[model samples]
Target: MKKTVHVVGAVIENDAQQILCAQRSPSMSLANLWEFPGGKIEAGETPQQALKREIMEELDCVIDVGDKVEDTTYEYENVIVRLETYKAKITEGAPIAKEHAQLIWKKRIELPALEWAAADIPAVEQLTK
Candidate 1:
């Protein structure tokens, strides 16, 4: 059986109405694809909690997590991913791409122009609507 990984993604929007997107590093599984910045849910953590921790680790910023955005389950070659995304705002510090190859803020309408990871596509659609 393929392992199912539970992960959380933060769809962080700034006051400018732009969304933050992260590019997967070359060493990462989905290299060069864009995604919301977040990581796997650890034991004893809620989805919100996981997102906060992940944003701090991956982007070096603190965020105020808000409503659930999208929930998707996607099956890849070796694993199944259950991705839970939430609306968020950076409460402190600017985002610095600590783990990802790059980070950029894009308008909702422009989001589709980038190639996104499969698991993140649903949330991207939801935000674009």
Candidate 2:
């Protein structure tokens, strides 16, 4: 049986209206693909709490998690991921790529142009709508 991993993601938008995207590092399971910048939800943490914690740990920044944008399950070859995404705004510090290969801010229309992680595609589609 495939392990189901519950993860939380953030669609962090800046004042310029561009969404923050991160590239998974080479050592990650899904390396080099773009994602909405978050991580697996730790046990006992709410989605919001997980999002806040993941952003802090991954980007060295604080964020205020907003409404949930997507909640869907996607199966990778090795695991099934339930990715829950929420709209977020940075509240402190700058986003520094601590665990990712890179970070980019792009407009919604440009989101589809990049190769995104399979799990993040649905939220990207909804954002572009």
Candidate 3:
């Protein structure tokens, strides 16, 4: 049976209205692929809390998780994942890429041009619309 992994992502926007995107590390499962920043929702944590913690841990910054953007359950080649993405804004320091290979800020129109993770495609389509 496939375990359903619950995760959260942030559609973080900067002052320039550019959305933040992250590239997976070479060692990660989806290496070199672009994704919204976030991680799994650990035990006893709400989706919002998990997103905040993930952004802080993965990007080394703080964020105010706003309204949810997309909630999707996708079946990857291996694991099945439920990804909930929220609109967010940085409330503290700038994001520093410590785990990801790189970060980029992009306009909504440019979102579809990048190679986004399959699970993130729904959110990207939502953003681009």
Candidate 4:
């Protein structure tokens, strides 16, 4: 039986209409791909809680989770991920690339220039619309 991982992602936008994207660490599974800042859902944690914790751990910032936006499921060669995505607003601390290689804030229209993760492509398409 294949194990499914429940992940949480945040579609965070700033006042300048730029969305936050993080480059996966070169040592990570999906290296160099741009993705919404998030991580796996831990045991006993809600999706929102996991999102907040993951963002803080990965970016060294605090964020307030907003409305639930969308959920998507994608299958990788080794495992399936059910990603629950949500809108989030920064409440404190400037974001730092603690886990990722780099970070960028991009206009929604310009997202095509960055190479995004295959699972994240659908979410980006939905956001661009």
Candidate 5:
């Protein structure tokens, strides 16, 4: 089987020390789950380039790619994702969920209450800590 490598980006804002999160679209595979905004890395694109494109397409915003926080690999029923998470800062535009159902800003302590994608569990834990 051919494994698909997907690069995912996580956007974080220091709102007095909190992070921004978006709810996944109901029609999406990981429906109703809360996640840091990101998407798959397309062919011929670097992970950073892919992240910038995905954020622009999904949130209609510009972000400054910060330090790479973590790289994780996880498996789903249909595909495997090599999720590359980064600590991102929004340079311009407000975040609107063009692809997601809703958006939210949460403190580190509140992260566990929101439903997160299975692959994101570890990432979430790390972020909250």
Candidate 6:
């Protein structure tokens, strides 16, 4: 049976109303695809906690997580991904891509121009709508 990985993503929007997007590094599984910055939910941690920790680790920034944005379950070749995205705002420090190839802030309308990871598509669509 394929294992399911539950993950949280943050749709961080700045004062300019642009959303933060991260590009997966060459070494990452979904290399070169864009995604919201976040990671897997560790045991015993609430989704909010995992999101905070992940943003700090992956983006070197602190965020205030808000309402849930979207939830999607996608099956890949080797695993099933359950991704939950939430609205967020950076509270401390600017984002610096620590694990990704790069980071960009884009308007919701422009989000569809980039190739996104499959699991993140639903959230992107929601944000653009």
State TM-scores per candidate.
0.99, 0.98, 0.98, 0.94, 0.92, 0.99
Whole-structure CA lDDT of model 1: 0.96
- Give candidate 4's error at residue 83 in angstroms: 1.0
Candidate 4, poorest ten consecutive residues by summed lDDT: 117-126
User: What C-alpha lDDT, on a 0 to 100 scale, does residue 10 get in candidate 6?
Assistant: 98
lDDT of 1 by residue, 106-129 (tens): 999999999999999999999988
Q: Tell me model 2's lDDT, rounded to 2 decimals.
A: 0.95
For residues 22-124, write the lDDT of model 5, one tens digit per residue: 8888898889988888988888988888888898999898888887767888888888878888888888898888988998888888989999887777878
What is the TM-score (0 to 1) of candidate 2? 0.98
The model with the greater TM-score, 4 or 6, is 6
- Misplaced by over 4 Å in model 2 are none
- Which residue pairs show collisions in model 2? none
Error of 6 at 13 (Å): 0.1
The local distance difference test score of each candidate is 0.96, 0.95, 0.95, 0.88, 0.83, 0.97
What TM-score does candidate 5 reach? 0.92
Q: For candidate 5, which ten residues in a row score worst on lDDT?
A: 8-17
Score candidate 6 by TM-score against the native: 0.99
**How far off is residue 21 in model 2, in Å?**
0.5
Q: Per-residue CA lDDT of candidate 4, range 14-91, in tens?
A: 889888999999999889999999999999999999999998898888899998777888898888888888889888
TM-score of 1: 0.99
> How big is the positional error of residue 96 in model 5, measured in Å on the Cα after superposition?
0.8
Better-scoring candidate (TM-score), 2 or 4 = 2
Measured with C-alpha atoms, the lDDT of residue 86 in candidate 3 is: 100
Clashing residue pairs for model 1 = none
Per-residue accuracy of model 3 over 1-129 as CA lDDT, tens digit each:
888899999999999999999999899998999999999999999999999999999998999999989999999888999999999999999999999999999999999999989999999999988
In order of listing, the candidates' clash counts read: 0, 0, 0, 0, 0, 0
